[model samples]
Target: MQFTEDKSRSRMTLRSAVPKTEQKPERKQPVQELPYIKYFGNIYYFTDSIDCAIYCDKILSQVDKTPGNTIIGFDMEWPFNFQTGSGKTALIQLSSTIYDCYLFHVTEFKKLPKALTELLSHSNVRLVGVNIKNDIHKLSRDFPGINSTAMLNNCIDLRTQANITLNCKQNWSMAKLVNHFLRMQINKDKRVRNSKWNVVPLNNAQKLYAAIDAYVRITLVEMGDKTKVFQYNYENNTVDICINIPFYDSVEELTYILIKRHDLPIYVDKDLIQKLSDFSLQCNLDYYDNSTTELINHSKLNAAEVEDIIKDWERLMREETADYGEKGCASDEELFATAYHKLVHSPALETMLQLEYMYAQTVRQRVNDKDQQIKSLSETQTDEMNKAVDRLEEDMTEAEINEIAARHFDDQTLLQVKLTSELETIKEAQRREYREWVMQMLEQNQANSSLPTPKNSPLAPVPPGPIRETKEDRRKILQSVVLEESFTIHLGSQLKQMHNIRILSADVMDFCAVNDNEQISDTTPQLLQTALGLYSNDLCGLVLMTDSVIGSRLTKDFTEICQRSTEFHFPHIDDQLEIISNTAKKYQMESCNNRNSSSKHLQPGDVYITRHSNLSQVHIIFHMVSDDSLRANDINSRHPVVLGLRNILKTACSNDITSLTIPLLLQYEMTEEMTVTWCAKRAELVFKCVKGFMIEMASWGGSDLKNLQFLLPQGISSDVFQSLTGMLPSIFKVSNPLILKSSSIVK
Candidate 1:
C-alpha cells in the first residue's frame, strides 16, 4: 500500500473545471395552412326531372368507370314540418371526386314519394352524409328498409367521424364544423325557407344550394380522416370511430330508431273533421247565396255576431236537454238546433187564434129569483091545503097530480084557492116589485141595448174559474241515487264478542286461568279478553321492572334478550301473553345457583365444584358480590365471582364442555339444603321460594325479591363468574359476602 497522501493531485483536479455558457430560447413555429376551396358559383343547377335524370346519369357513368374505392358524397333534403302528414323531400344531392356535381329533383320522383325507399334499396351505392339519421327518418316514411346497421355499415356519417377524430368538447353540427374547420359559413336561411321541392319548376338558387351542401359534407369526411382523430381499422371489417355511435342498416331499423328519437306521427280522426266542416256550413246557412240575398245584405249584425248567437243558443239547448250527452251533440246537430229554436221563438211570428163562443161563456152569468120568491110566500100562509097538495105530489108526477086535483075539485075550487090564498098576496107584492124593477131595467136595457153590451161589464160576462195556474200541474223532481246498493258486510255475533276485550285490567292472571276452562260457552271472547289483559300486564311490568331482577337477568348479562323482548311487535294479544310467559321462565332459569358448598357458608378461598362427564377435570368459579349499590363500582371492583366466572366461561368455551353438573350452596351462613340433587332443581325452587318471599316482603313495605335481586352461584370460572355477577346490581344492591376456612368461618 502506498502510504503517501494524494492531496496535491486532488487540488489540481478541483482547479481544472471549465466555465458554463448561457443558452438562448427557441422561437415558436408558425401554424401551417390547411387546403381550402372557395366553393363559389352555381354548381350545375338541376331543377326539373329531365335535368336531374341527366345529372344522375352523368355521375353514375363517372362512378362506374372509376377504379378502386369510390367515395361518393351524398346528402338528402326533406320537409321537416311535424304538423303536416305530407311525406316529401325537396332534393337529393350527390357528389364525388370523379363526377362534377349532381342534384336529383326528389319532388319529381313522386311529389311526396318514398325517396328513402328508392335510395336505400340500391346496394351498389354507398350513401354518406352528416347526421343522416333525421333524413333516414323522413325517408323511412316511403322506404322502410333503411335501419341502423345499413346506414352504419354501408353509409358513412362524417359528423360521427369528426367527433371521434377531434376529441370534440361537445356534439358539433355540420354548420358548426364547416365554420370552425373550413372557415367558410354557408347560409341556412335558404335551406329552411326555400320553395317546397315537391312543387314543379325548381329555381336555380335552390338547385345550387343542394349541390353545395353535398360538397361541404364530402370535405368534412376528408378532413376527419386526415386528422387521425378517428383511425379506420378494417381488421374487424368495422369502422372504429372515436365514440361508439349506434348504427342502422334497414328502413325498419331506422324507423324504430326514429320512433325512439322523435316519437311516432299522430293520427287525426276523420269523423271529427267531417263534423266540424258540417257545423261551419250550418252556422253560415242564413248567409247562403241561395237564400234571400236581401235578408243577408240588409242584416245589421255581422257574420261573427250571428255566429255568436248561434253558439249561445246551442249551448242553452245542450244544458236544458239530454238530446246530447254531457259532452254535447256533434257540432252539426248543435248548429241546426240552435237556428231552428231561435227562429220558432222570434217576436216577429204571428199571434194565436181566439174563439168567440169560448169567450162568451167565460164572460156571462144568469141569476134566477122566481123560485126564491114563491118559497117565501108559501111559508107565510096557513098552508094545510098547500101542504096536502105537496104530499100527494111526492108520490105522483106533475101531470098525474094535476089530473087527480082536477077530478077532486071543480074549476071554481081551483080558481078560489089560486086567487084567495096568501099566494095572491105574495103574487101582488112580487108583481109590484117586478113592475118597478122592470120599469127601471126596461129603461136601462133600452139605453144599453141601443149601444151594444159592454164586453167586460159584470152584467156582460166573467172569465171561467180564473184560468187555473199552469205551475200547479208540474211534478216535483227527486234527487238521483249514485250508488245502487251497499257493498259492506257486518261481522257475526261470535266475532263481535271477541273484539270487546280491555287489555289493561289488573285481573289478567285470573282472566287467563278462567279462560282455560272448557265449560265456558263463549270461549273465544273470554280467551281474547284474557290474552289482551296478559299483554297489557307484560308491557307495563317490563317498563316498571327495568331496574328489577327480571330486568337484571334480561338487561345486564343478557341484554340481547331484553332487547328482543322489548323490540318484539305482537300484532295479536295471544302472542304477547305467550312471549311474557316464555321470557319470565328464561330469566328465572338463568339466575339459578349451580355450584357447590360443603361448608355452612361460601368463602373466597373455598373451592366450589362443577363437573361434566366429557371433561377430565372439574371447573370452578369463585363467588363474590359487590357491596356498592353503584353499577360502576361493582364492574370495576374485580369481585371474586366476576373474575372466577370469566375464567370458567373462557375454559368451558375453549374446552367445549359437553355435559356439566353443578352443586348449589348458600353464600351467607344458613342451614338450607345443600345436596347436589336439591341444587339440580334449584332454579325452580328458588323462583317459587323467591316469589313467596317477595309477596311477604312486598306486604311489609319491602320490594319484591323477584323485582330486587338475582341469584347466581360461586364455583364457575372468571368469565362465567363475571357475567353472572354483572346481573346482580340491576336487581339487588349487594352489600356483603361470607368467607370460610377449612369448612369453617374465618372471621
Candidate 2:
C-alpha cells in the first residue's frame, strides 16, 4: 500500500506540511457593534417603489412556503429639525430574519407599493416591534391619505409582550430588549439613531443600524422562552435585570449555533413540537390529534416532501426520548451541585416581586370597581330607555327614544372615562385647579379671559398638570404659593445631631405620593422601592391621623389617598386598612379592659400600623386613631390625640424610619373653628412633644429621625399657616452657632 503512494504526499508528510485547509477562520461576522449588539444581517436598500415591491413580492412568494404565522419586523425613521419637531416619514424598514432585511426609502417613492401596504395591514400577518403602535401612527401622520391606524390590525407591541413575559415595565426601549435577549450591544448613539433618514444614498452605518433595529423585533418574538425576569431602569437609558440562577449560561449560544449548523437562520426544525403547541390554541383534541396518514393527506405535499417531514418529526421525537448522556456522565446529585454553583439569592428580586404582587392586587381591585361602575351605567341606561319608551308611546318614533338613551349612555361614558388610570380623578381635580389658576394668571397679565375664538367658546386655559410639587420639573411648569419654612434643628442631648425640620401648609397625602407622577422615562425609576433603602433601615413614615372608627366609611377622606393606584408591590390601601382592622379586633380581644367597649372599635390615641411600597414617600403609615377632640378649640398636650402623636414618634424612633411626616394640626383638614389661637396652640403642643420625644430617642437605641415635615392642610389661610410656622421655631430650638474669624497681624 505504501509503495503505491505519491512521493510528494507520502509517509513522512508530517515533515512536508502541517495541518491546513482551504477554509479560513471565520470572524463572528458582526455587521454593526454599538452599545452592545453584534448584528449579523444583509441590508437590502431600495429607493424606488417599483424595486421595493418586486423585492417584497419575491420574499412573500418564498415566505408562503414556510410553516407558521408570517411575522415581519417593522420600524420607521423620519427627518427631524430640533426647532420644528419631526418631519415626514422618509424610510421604512422590514425584516423576517437577520439575513433578510429591507429599507424602503419612501421619500423617493413616487407611489407607495400596494403589496407593502397590504402586508403591513394584513390581518394574518404580524408586524412586530417595540412601541410599534407609535410607528404605525407615524405612517398615518406622514401619509394623510392612508388610514394606517385603522387598517393596521396586525401590529404586535414587543413592549407589551415584554411586560407579560419578562415581567419588565411597559416602557422598555429597543436597545434594552436587545441587550437582554441577545446579550450584545445595540447602537443608540444620538448621531446614528437620529440621523437624516430623508437623505438619499443612505450611509453604511445608517443602513446597518436601521436593519438591526427592525430585524431584532422578529428575532425577539420568535425566540419564545416566556421566562419571567425583573428589571430596574433606575438610571437614564440603562436597565438591570435579574441574573437568574442555574440556566443562565451559553444555552442561547448553543441553540443559535445548532440552528446555524443546520442552515436555519433562527430556530431548529420543530414540526412535531409545532403541532403539539397548536393544542394550546383550542381545547378540542380532535383539532390537533390525527393519524400520520390523515396528517400527510391534509399537508398538501408530494410523497417525498411528506416523507421528509415525517422523518424530521420522528428524529426529533427519538432525540427527545434518547439518553442525553446524563446518568452515564454524572449522577443526579452531581447535576444539582453544578446547578447550585450558579444559584444566587436576590434580595432586590424579592422586593420587586412583592411590589408586583401589590400592583396586581390594586389593578384587580380597580378592575372590580370599574366593572361595578359599568354595571351601574348599563342598568341606568336600561331604566332610562324604558322610561323614554313608555313616556313617548305613539307620540315619537322608537328611534327617537333610542337616540335619547344613546345620548345618555355617551355622556355617562365620557364622565366615567376620566377615571380610567393613574388616578384620573386626581388628574381631573388638577385640571380644574389649573384652569382656575390659569384664569387668574391671565387676569393678572390683563389678557382677556372672556375672549371668544372662531368657535365662540371663551378662552379657558389649563396648564399641562395641576403639577405636583414633588418633581423638580414641577417648578418649571407651575409656581406654588405654599407657606413653608425649613430649619436645621439638633435633637437628643448627648447624641445631638442635625435634622431637617420643615413647616408647610400642604395636603397630608402629598407626603405619601412618592413624587413619581413625572412621566416614566429612561431617567425615571418608579414602581419598585429601591432595595438599598429596604436593607439600610432608611425607612419613611407618614402619620395618617384617623378617626376612632378604625376602618369605617368616614375614614375615606384621608385613607383614600393611600387607596390610589401604587406603581407595584404593595397591597391596596383599603386592603391594608382591613388587615389592620382585623388585627385590632384581635388586640382588643386580648387586652381590652372594658368588657362593655364596642368589640373592635378603636379608642382615642390607639395606633395601628400599615406597610406599603410605591405609595408616594412613606414605607410605613401610622394610622393613629383620634376623636373629634382635635376639632375642639381647647385641647391641651394631655389630649389622647396628642398622646397618640407622642406614641407615633416613639415607635418611629425605635423603628428604622429615618423620615417622618406628621400633620401639624393633628388633622387632615382645617375647620372654621380652628382659629389662629387654636392653630398656634396645636402647633406648639406638637412641636414641644416631638422635641421631648427626640431627647428620649437616644435612650431607645434605633434610627434617629433625620427629617420631620409638619404638614398643614392645603387650604390653610396665609396668616394661620404663618402663625403655625412661626410657632415651630419658638418650640424646636434650631441651633445657629455664630462663627467669628480672628485676623492675625503677627510678624
Candidate 3:
C-alpha cells in the first residue's frame, strides 16, 4: 500500500529550467502614481558650523512671528549598516515654516555650534516628526556638548498627534500621515532611506527626501489639529484644554470610559460625570485657572494605592440582598469583596437602608401594575417579552427586523444552520440517487431513445458504453415481473385489500423524493413539478429516525451529514427544535407531576415533524427519536423505532403519502456489528413488522396505502440484498400464482 512520492511531479521540469539570461521578465501592470510632496520654500543646506549657526538664528527669529507655540518639523538621518549597526547622526533637517527649511550636514561640522544649540533649545518652539523623541535623543547623543532633550521639551510625535486629530488610533507612517492630511505622497522607499547619508553634498533625491520629511510635519499639524478637542485620554482622566474644545460628546460615554480605562472605581453613580462637568462650566473655572502652567501641568494625586477587592461581585451582591424571610441579617449576608466594603457608611445608615428596601418593594409593585396595564392596552399586545414583537406589522421594515435579529443573532444562526444542514444532507443523498438511477435507466433504454449530442460544447454530457438486448429478453423480463404478484389479498372475511410493496437497497431519501431534473432537457419540468407539489396536499413525508437525544445534534449519522452540508432552506431550525423539546418536556412534567420519573428529557418513540420546501425532496420530515435498545442483540418487534414507524406509516397513509421509505435496520448506515446474520435478522424484524402493519391498514383505511419500501443501507452485499429480497416476497406471499405448463405437455 505504501509508495514513494514522485518529487519530480512538484519540482520544476528540465525543460522549464531556463537560464537567467534567457528568461524574459514579466511586465507588471502599471499603477497610477501619486504626486510627490513638494515644498515651495527656501532650502538652506548647512555643512560647516558657520552656515548652520546662521540658519539657526534665522529659524529662531522667524518661528515666533506667529505669536503662539511655533511648530518646527524636525528630522534626523544617519548611516546604518545591517551588520555593523547605526553610525553617529550625519544629517538633521528642521523647518519652522513651509517656505524655510534647513538641512544640517553635521558630519562635516567641527561641533554643534553654541548658536544652533541655543536656537533649538529656545522656548515656544515645538519639534515634530514621526520619531521626534528618538531623533532628538540621537542629536544629543551624537554631540554630547549640547542638551538637545531639555531644549526640545515641546516635542510632538506625528503618529500620536495624527491619531488625536483623525479621531482614530492607527499605526501611522510619516508618508501615510502626509497622504491622509496633505493628500500627497512622500517617497519613503527602501533605496532612498538606506542610501549613504554621511556623504558631503547630498543628491537631489536625498535633499528633497530630507527636506520633505521635516517640512510635511508642520503642514500636517497645521491642517490636522483644526478639531478643537486635541486629546481626551480616559486612562489619565485628562483632556487637552485646547482653545476651541468640542463639548458636544455624550457625557454618559465619557463617564463609562473614565471608569473603565482610568480604574477610578467600579461603584459608578448614574450621573456623577455629568454633574461635575456642568458645575465646572457654570462656575467658569477656566477663567480663574488662567495662570496654570503650560503643557499638562495639572497637579498630581498623592498616592498610596490599595489592592482591588472586588471578586465574585454578582454572587456576593445576590447573597447580600437575598431574602431570608426575616428582618435580621445572616452571616452569609456580609459582602467583603464589594467596592464599598472598606468605605464609611452614611450618617443615617439604617434609615438609608430602610428607604432603599422600601423603594425596591415599591418598584416591584409598580412593575407588576405596568405588566397588567400592558396586557389590557391592546388585544394584540402581551406582557410577555418574547411575544411583544409578534404584534409587529406584517410589512415591518427589514432594518426593523434586523434590529430585533441582532439582539438574538447567535440563537437564530444556530437554528438556521441546523435545519439547513438537515435539509441539504437529505438533498445531497437524493441528488446522488437521482444521477445514478438516471444513468442506469438510460443504459437500459439506450436502444429506444437516442441521446442528443451538442456540437462543440465541452460541458455537454455523453452516454456511456452500449449494451444490446433483444425483443425476447424484454418479453421474458415482463413475464417474470408479472409473477412478482398481485397486490390484492383477502385480509378480513370477504374483504379484499390492495397495498403495494417495494424494496430498495439504498437510503430512505431515494423513495420519498424523486429526481425531477434527471431527463435530458430543460429544468422546466423539475421546476414546475417542484412548484406545484412543494406546498400542496400531495406532500412527501420522510421518517428521520434519530437517537433518544431530543435536539437534532450532529453525530456520525445523517444529522452530522446535514449539519456539515452548506445547502438548506431556512426558517430557524433552532426554534423548531426548542419548541419540540419544550413541548416534550411539558408533557413529561404534566403527565408525571407528582411521580419520580426518568422522562425529564425526550425518550424513545418521540416523534416531531418539521415542514420544508425547496431545500430537499421531502416536504415533511418526521424526526422520530429511538434508543440503544434498537441496537441491542435481543431486540424484538416491539422496538421503539418499529412502534414509531407504525405511527409514521399511519400518519403518512392518512395524509396521502401513498409511498414511503422506512429504514429496515432503523439506521441509515451499516455498523461494525451489522454482520450478515445481523442484517438478515433486523431485515426480517422490520419486514414482518411492516407486513403486519399493512394487513391492519384495511381497518384503519383513512386513505390508500399503496407503496411501502423497506430500505436497506447502501454497501450491503448482493447476498444481503437478495436475502432481504427473498424475505419480502415470501413474507408478503403471492395470493394468485401463474402456473406455467411443462415443455412436454405444451408439445
Taken over the whole model, the C-alpha lDDT of each candidate is 0.37, 0.62, 0.57
Assess candidate 3 and give its TM-score to the true structure.
0.32
Q: Kindly provide the TM-score of model 1 when superposed on the true structure, using C-alpha atoms.
A: 0.24
True-structure lDDT of candidate 1: 0.37
Question: Which has the higher lDDT value, candidate number 2 or candidate number 3?
Answer: 2
lDDT of 1 at 231: 22
lDDT of 2 by residue, 1-747 (tens): 001113663211001011122123545434255345556756789988888888777666645655544667889888899999998888999986545688999986655787777667755566777788888887877665555764456566666655544333657788766765555667777887788888898887889888888877766654442222222222253222222222334444534443454344342335323432343333223323422333444344335656887888877766676653223476544543232222112322332233333333444466458768777877888897787777785677878987887798787777567556545444344334323433343344345423212121112342444534556666623434676888888765575788999888776665554343332212223333442354346788888877777666435754554545442234456667788778878878866645536545788888888776546456787888877777887788788877888788789888889888888878767778878888887778788888887777767877888989888887788888767766666777687777755665354
In candidate 2, what residue range of length 10 has the lowest lDDT sum?
11-20
Ranking by TM-score: 2, 3, 1
Encode model 3's per-residue lDDT on 508-610: one tens digit a residue. 5443332322222222222233233543346666677776566544222443322322222333344456687788777877667344486566667767876
Clashes in each model (backbone N, CA, C under 3 Å)? 45, 13, 2
Residue 175 C-alpha lDDT in model 3: 74
Q: Per-residue CA lDDT of candidate 1, range 1-747, in tens?
A: 001113653210111011111122345232233333445533555566565555555445544554433456777765555577454666667766312456665555543223333344344555667777766666655543445455445565556555433444467676766665566666566554444766655555566666777888665544333221112222353221221111112423433433343343323224323433343344345234423442453232235556877889888887887775376356733443333233223321111001111121221210013234434444434253465567774765667656655644564455445543443344344334323432343345446532223223233343434423234223211211111111111122243201110111121112112111122212123222212222121111111112222223212332221111111111222233355446645544544334332322232322222111111111111122222231221122243433433333233333333212211122221123433334333323333333233333323431111112222332223443343333323332233345556757565
How many backbone overlaps does candidate 3 show?
A: 2
Per-candidate TM vs. native?
0.24, 0.39, 0.32
